[model samples]
Target chain A: MPIRNTDHAWGSINKAFHWILALLIIGMGFLGWYMTWLPNAPGKIKIYALHKSIGLTILALVLLRILWRQFDRRPSELPMPHWQAVAARGVHIALYGVMLLMPLSGWLFNSAGNFPLQWFGLFHVPSLTDGENPALKAIAGITHLILFWVLLVAFVLHAGGALKHHFIDRDSTLRRMLPWGTRAEKSSPPPAMTATHSTPNSSSPTEVKS
Target chain B: MKTVLLFVLASGFCASAGARDWSTDAAASKLGFSGTYQNEKFEGQFKKFDAVISFDAADLSKAKFDVTVDVASVNTANEERDGSLKDKEFFDFAKFPKAHFVTSAFRKAADGSIEADGTLTVRDKSKPVTLKVKFSEAGDKATLDADTKLNRLDFDVGSGDWKDTSIIGADVLVHAHLSLTAKAG
Candidate 1:
């Protein structure tokens, strides 16, 4: 009567954090890309501020996730091949590593730059390094750009894997993460007795034959 | 002895008359100077320049100066950006190749400094600017340091959204150090 290891899925809190953080990271990447080309647009400041705030939020959440994982036990592993399990673990680890690196790199980049970094205009964030050093600034700039590309590729790979399991594997790969459809009993459709036989005219007589 | 005295007086009159002319430099006087300028949140120095000043300090009352600045020779040390600055949007060196400051009024200040109020035309836009010149007498040389504030927008140097201080700052400070050699009038 107990669930097997193959049936194990992520808990509610883990599922929520994973999906929300994924969405935020993807959104931040797109905003960063678009910002480079919009030359002095009116909405540039608003969008840029939102980008900074979201990036900082992601950094905080990633740190918390690290701490949480340290104390909490994750779901039992799926009864897959050894190679598949190893590959899954490796990709998962890489994802978390990049998630932490991307934002921190961006923070350092803005700090080294001569331009001041603002967090939604409410407060001023001081530079991490002096902007006068052109060499340091260039190094930070180049690495920041490279990390962005890596983060983008990694995100696509993560999303693609999830979609593959949902459509091709036809498993509860995505269902386990769906907030409202997790309950076993509630997961199934209701009985189809009278509702299946009812015609369109039952609710509105306009559909009845004259 | 009376004839000798008349000759000395007449020679003194001729020398003073020659000094009154704008061409007089009062014994090969050299003007040496230095200053600072602000661009956006960045402030830099004008490293190298020579102003061939030919105005008499005493005859500054009736003196006029046509000062020329080498447009291609401005060095802010930011070569990439400064290179673009020499282009049409800013300096337009191809059309108006040189920037000029022509003077009409030169007043001696109470603090022994000289203030020259002139029209500096850059990129074809002329604005009245007063450069307060501070000088130190070193033998026959005049060490001159002048400072003045410049509005980039007034000369159409930078305008529109580029004027936003958050992006590229507006107020540009033009500081000058000039070395001039004076010639006899």
Candidate 2:
């Protein structure tokens, strides 16, 4: 597989970003949920700080992913029903939107409260607001809190769609995006697709290792 | 300004004799404080504070100041921090609505600056404090600018998590800038 994306599969760079963000988002969800429940203590503050730092990291990585996407072509959409394809596209868009927006809302909430922002405690990030703005602070904080639910729903839908393609329809939707190598044809195709096709595109018989 | 002119004239006429009383222009004065929050520096001001001033350049023994600051008026530019600051673990504004400062004596420093010895009362604790003062008397208006450093822990201002000074420093720099008008004798 190539380092850059191909017409049929994702690049290593894209896959790395996808999985890394996925893991971080999952971790952040737990941290965010747990920290709010903790009693007001020094330990809670530390955890909150860590959450901010990791959230900022995710924000930076999301930007890089979007920027890379500008230069990198996406693999063609797998063949599916028109409604499923549309739903999949909507889910993907919403996921990307949440990924980009979550950090910004957090930053606004921080800035609106005129709170300190440090990138992993290395340096400060400039505040967006001038001073203590009660209205903006409340609004931004609510937005930040609410977006977590949006992220969770979008993630479930996205993952569910991929699984559906893998199990029910049995296509290359999931395999093309998988981290490991598989010919996407030999082992990944539905039994019906394999039985009908004799001429496969490119490559000799590479062993399927999924 | 008319009062200021009269007070200035009075002070000038009696400069050789005694200390003159002055009143602060609340609109033109500020009581500010600053400290670090993590790696970032945060600044705040006490919006409601009143100071009574009596001073003479030559009469150090007679110079005195009494100030009352509303603890609940503390604004750190951060609303969450400001809210947190008023809680029981911090200023406990519900219990102690006011902080007080009173200067008992004044002395000229070796560097020809002035220092006022005083006691600052915050929450339930009182501590001896000294304010480094730069008292500049303009022709018609006198300005009283003073600065002092305070340890919040000294007064039990920050109790629970705030004791971790590494995250939020215990040392707070308090500054006062009062636009003063002399009161006629």
Q: Which portions of model 1 show Cα errors greater than 4 Å?
A: A1-20, A35-79, A103-116, A121-142, A167-210, B1-40, B45-48, B54-67, B72-87, B108-114, B138-143, B160-166, B177-185
Residue-level lDDT tens digits of model 2 in B68-148: 999899887765677788889988888999999999889999999999999999988999999999888875579999999
Model 1 has a clash total of 9
Per-model TM-score, in order, reads 0.64, 0.87
Q: Model 1 over residues B1-185: C-alpha lDDT tens digits?
A: 99999999998775555432222232333222212212224444433333445445656665555666667666444444456566666667688777778877889888877898999888889999988866544444555556777777788764454445554455665655544434443
lDDT of 1 at A70: 69
DockQ, candidate 1, vs. native dimer: 0.06
Model 2, span A105-161: residue lDDT tens: 988888877778888788877888886677988898898888999999988888877
Residue clash pairs of candidate 2: none
What are the root-mean-square deviations of the candidates from the true structure over C-alphas?
12.5, 6.2
